[model samples]
Target: MTPLAIPAHERHGIRVFAAALSPEEMQRDKAGLVAALFGDPDLDPAHVELFDTADLAGVGLAGYLAEGLGVSDAALAPDRARLEAVRGPVLILHSRALHGRAVTLIPDPRLTLLAGYTEERPPVHFEPLPSDAAKGSLTAPGPSAPAPRLPRRALALGAALLLAGLAALVLAWR
Candidate 1:
């Protein structure tokens, strides 16, 4: 399904038209026609609005639209009245069904299926940590205080001897 990002004013108008379309009448071009009537610039064969009235328990339909369109739910809230005007390819999600309701008039033939909601993953780097700071911090634990004046060769030999002693101890313990 194509995802349409409608602006606030437009979404309200579309919602009104969609609510009236129902499930039977809104098939294919019909949906496009309704959208076009509502002045939808992107209302073409490829781009169309899918009226989702699914399991909106935690988040309401407006919220879902907001999340889907990447906008605030308040923007879509005022358009409910307009949304109730159109009957088109509408999918009532979840176990809830709209029956005989005035807003639920017109069977949208385009309303074929009502799929479950799928949460969208935000952008991969939408909230990336400050890279410069992260990189600086990663390398910030500086050279470990210069090892208190131990010579490089002496340190190496000491490490080797320590390792040998540890190996011997392990062997002895075993």
Candidate 2:
């Protein structure tokens, strides 16, 4: 499967976590993948999360990855292509690793696969984003409507004049 993408704006908030399990490993231990994630010292225990891609079976995997994981289309497209070429269950690993720390997305060129594997893993890495990299820009503000005009002062003055004229008429009649 394709690796998850950390947005430019959220680069500091998340880490790119990717792992692949052979069909044998999956069959041997349902928690093997979880163990691998927890076993790593560099990965923060609190930030690590695993999602079974098998859960997304028959559903639009691309859309789910985009919406749920906030994966960019750039990453999702390649992953979708790879998944289409394979069969069987795929598990998705998502880990923040460190809170508010930027991790760079470096594509791993080597595809790691175990014996009798039903799925393939693309090269992926989560490293610190370079300081010189351009940061993502915030969304631009939309056009604002002009404020409505209200004649509050004129209305108040008219009401006061009417009240004074009535009071004068009443005194004259008296």
Q: Which segments of candidate 1 are over 4 A away from where they belong?
A: 1-17, 29-42, 52-58, 73-174
| True lDDT of residue 134, candidate 2 | 48
TM-score of 1: 0.29
Per-residue lDDT of candidate 2, residues 7-49 (tens digit): 3324323232334545555555334444453343344444444
Tell me the TM-score of each prediction against the true structure. 0.29, 0.34
lDDT of 1 by residue, 12-88 (tens): 12232234453444454654554443333333323334453443556555555566545444555566444333333
**TM-score, model 2 to reference:** 0.34
Query: Worst 10-residue stretch by lDDT in candidate 1?
Result: 93-102
- Cα lDDT for residue 138, model 2? 62
True-vs-predicted CA distance for residue 148, candidate 1, Å: 46
